[model samples]
Target chain A: MNIQALKTYLNCDNGFLLSLVQKFVEELNDTTNKITLAWQNQNLTSIKLNAHKLLSSVKVMQLKELTLSLEKIEAGAASKHISSELEEDIKQLDIQVKKVINDLQLTIEELEANSPCI
Target chain B: MVFKCAIIDDDPFFTELINHYISQVDSIECCGIYHNPFDALNKVNFQEIDFLFLDIEMPEMNGLEFLKSLTTLPPTVFVSGKTTYGVDAFENNAIDYLYKPVSFARFSKCVNKIKAHFEHTRTNSQVKQQNIFIKHNGIHIRLAVDDIFVIRAHDNDVTLNTNVRSYKTHLRLKDIYDMLPLNDFMQVHRSFIVQLAKIDKVDGEIIEINGRTIPVSRTYLGELYERLKIK
Candidate 1:
């Protein structure tokens, strides 16, 4: 996604869009854990499919850094390259997700502190 | 006492509103607020709850189907956005119906009905030994052991004096006397059957309850003295 559009979506106006991002971040953390396990188990199809899905969604979420890294992982899985560099890039993406996730978590906590509901 | 209540609907906003309402209500405590009926169904199947606050339309499983699947039905008060399901909810044995954007007043009304039913059930369960079915006009109502103080036969109908109201029903005094449990209810005369528990004071030709007097007949005098342990 372009930087301007990313800024607009993250503006989140009334906090609704922000909550959806929080939910997405929550799902991404879970899917990343699953993707790594599938890769280690040499389930190439499962690994490729999971990385592809994450690649598309993280771009929508404006986590361009993670999105680009996941696309490489998807390509490496499809070609059965299983190279150490591709593995290191995917590992770095996991750390980046954790950091972005912490940022979203803080945003959610601040919003909830202001207005609590279901 | 808190009753476990489920809030089922597909709107997160409404679910949040319901959660807010439940937190404020004294009698009802929230079990969970679900945005889908399937999630609510999973909870109901696993939990022992006293009541359900179900919404009609859901994605996979609707409220009506969920209510049908319950093996043990707690009293359900349906919450919907419309009134067309009144007959449907009632036919499924719902205790009450609530429309969407539920106002506190309407919610209060539904809870009041559930409160009354629960209170009546608690008292009835304790006094199962003796019951008197009183016919008021065309309606037949069950009066429990603690309800009846005295039964007075007036001309062609039997007058049942209860703590709440007096009902006159067209049945033979003999038939009414026979209907009561033999041990607790004694036919003291042709016109009266006095509850052995409720007779606070007894005197010549008069049987009383809480300062009110009911007449006694000569034919049943022996039975009254026998019950009162009079010499």
Candidate 2:
């Protein structure tokens, strides 16, 4: 997970980036779980809203593919169509988001380890 | 001059990123940050801040609906992950629409626009804050803009209700309204124009100011609510 882009976009030092990414890592599970639950409940509005919330952080994390996938989910949910394709997309999104979370966790570890050095 | 701003986004990551960007700009400051629109709606004093950073989608109240429900709002910029709300944002008179994961470069541009807008409004308010001379009881009285709280029209004459006393002048209600600062006053009824800041409470169609009740007509009621900060 390359954080150089996130750092450049934030235009802040390592300390601020670590704090923000840590916060994102902390809240990521609950946010993705909300999306999953909303999908299971077939609550399209909740799905769209939660997906949009996740997108906000994913974009800042500089995950282009995840951002695009989330956008598709948000739009699909808004359309109120619970189709096989949308379900597949959501399933794939869950996998990708989990991987992203793992990567963010590693990034957090690296930042924390390097904090004293900086 | 440093301007105060508030951020209302459910996404803490986005809020933190935006807050960081705001801290970089010396001319702008973040006064508040709320994850829930409902909390912001109940707590935010629109008069205290120069502008707002609003998120369009929240679990409680969407940003567009939140902005609509408010009787008064500072200039707002909608920060959302979706690209679809651009037109809606502008329709609601949003200063700008920022797509989520906003870059520092884009945020800086938005800051410039807000600063320019406030500068224009400040210039207009300075020009609007002059005293008006009116004849009351055969005497030409000079009244400051802040002195009058209400203006009511009866026949061909209008009464200027101030804090201390009331003065009557032979002027049209529209004329009296035109003379007052537009931001501080609103025409709640055809025969009544009340200073928005001086409003004590509103019960349905009636607005109370200084222990006096003024009727708000249907024509201007919606707009009157839109202009005053309803708690």
Candidate 3:
């Protein structure tokens, strides 16, 4: 899992993503694990709906890479034709997103640490 | 928002035509098409559909009566070869009525009418925002409500100029007016709707927008002043 890429994906400015993590973080060691669980459990219906809502909001915010990746996963799942190899690739992509989120949070903490709000 | 269109007509050729027309326009997606109205209604019950391309004189359930049966109805555009139903169709407050073998040109006009209605409703809903979904060759493009810098009404169609690209939608000035947000847009001339915020300055007859001159018609100059609230 490319944790760095995952950090970048989740580090975006959408509150929904933050809320998404907060909603499901307890279920996995990483974002990929959680998303994979959703897929393996045959929750594509929920995933497809969430992916679409997120796509529109994310497009408005200009998160092109993240939006595209989410679209690919959703479209494949909805079509019910994605290979196991593609699923593995999506899992890797999930780790990349997790890294993005981690980096963004760390950067925010560092900026706040260097400055005194008091 | 993408419009999921359900088409009900016995003719497969016309159904195919409707599908072809829908495929050309990105705004309306063809969700389900049925020769039997009852079958179509069953599908509608299960799926979330936004628009219906209905034929009035069907075998089982008539289009008009079916509309009455809907718990919640989206806008509909009627397609029929006979002209007798045109007035009744319009009276039903359907978005637009079309005669069978719907031409691309007429189809475009119908789409414009629907877009205009949605635009107005959306503006009223948001109070100060207007957004348009543009479908050019089956691709839906969402433009920001305020991104339209100016709109130029040409020979038959209107060209929307924004900060990014020039979008050509088949529409007339009168039709476009209803869709534009009242707060941000004002018809200053016969062929122009200037974004009030985009107007750099207003002279006696002309206003400069994006370094281009837009005329203020004698008929609409007063309207512009009212819109501008110029003291």
Candidate 4:
């Protein structure tokens, strides 16, 4: 996760990028929770929809690895039953999203420290 | 001139990102950001908008479907994550297509294309507006220069005949003739100015126009012959 590279792509100030990252993390958390609940209930439709929604933000963040994982989960959700491998993929997706949230928080802190006002 | 634009996308993040990119360009203005295509369809006036940044794969009503539903569409640029929608976007006359994770560089290029398109359209419209307006029965009637067949003067009123209808206006024959294209229309009589293209057949001193035989006076006969290239 090259946070600086993503910021350059967005071409926004540190404050704006920080706000975007915070929003993205919040949305990601909510979507992950939805996927988990849908999986527990064996509602593949809900899982597919939630995973599809998550893909948009992940792709924007340029997290290629995470994007592929989410795509697999989204595709697998269309199936009647979740295979053991698909279950492992969902578990990995949760970990990967949380790791991104942590990395983004660190980036935000670094950005805040570099600001004159801070 | 600043071009007012609207963004119709299901994702709030994508809309926000596009809005941010639009702010970087000085000539483009963000008028509205609609998260729902259905809401945009109901609210947006296609004629009023200068540009539209649309996204495909939206829930409920997709971008392509929404575009199909519009009676008139502005220049549209499709911003989608999926590359498969590119073919359909161009087929529907979209100005450009920017794949998701759209960079500011890519978005700026699309804006340039839109500017060129607007300039081209404005130039064409200016040429089309070379027309004359006459007041008939308290209403101003506009007639294209090429559409007017003949102009006849009777005392104080001038009747202007066009391909569609005729209008009787209180204007001088000379005044209306001055407004018409000099090369296309010629005064063949004191009260009649016939569009050269509208003259079907000329027999002796009379010219047939829409079943009406208008006589060419002797004073202007030589000039008419010169205009018609008659030996």
iRMSD for every model? 13.5, 1.0, 19.3, 1.6
> Chain B, model 4, TM-score against the native?
0.56
lDDT of 2 by residue, A1-118 (tens): 5777767777877788889887887767887788889889999889888787888787777788898998899889989889887788889988987898888878888888778744
Model 2 agreement with the true structure over B58-168: per-residue lDDT tens digits: 887889899889887568899887788899888887888898779898999999988788666655755666688888989999998787888888988999988889999
Runs in model 3 with CA error above 4 Å? A1-118, B45-47, B129-231
Candidate 3 chain A: minimum summed lDDT over ten consecutive residues — where? A20-29
Q: What interface Cα RMSD is found for model 2?
A: 1.0
Single out the weakest 10-residue window by summed lDDT for candidate 1 chain A. Answer: A6-15
List the lowest-lDDT window of 10 residues for candidate 1 chain B. Answer: B121-130
Per-residue lDDT over B1-231 for candidate 1, one digit per residue giving the tens place of the 0 to 100 score: 345677776555446545655655566667777776666756654343567777775546768988787786667888765578999998886888876545445566777887676655555554455565667889988888678878888888888888988889998675665566655777666567777888888789787885688777665677678877888
Query: Local error of candidate 2 at A11, Å?
Result: 0.7
Q: Looking at model 4 chain A, report the run of 10 residues with the lowest lDDT sum.
A: A109-118
**What's the fnat for candidate 3, on a 0 to 1 scale?**
0.00
Model 1: which residue pairs collide? none
**Which rank order by TM-score, best down to worst?**
2, 4, 1, 3
Instruction: Evaluate model 1: give its TM-score.
Output: 0.38
Shift of residue A14 alpha carbon in model 3, Å? 47
**Candidate that would win on TM-score:** 2
Shift in Å, residue B4, candidate 3: 2.5
Model 1 misplacement above 4 A: A1-118, B45-47, B128-231
Residue A16 Cα positional deviation in candidate 2, in Å, after optimal superposition? 1.0
Query: DockQ scores for all the models shown?
Result: 0.03, 0.61, 0.01, 0.30
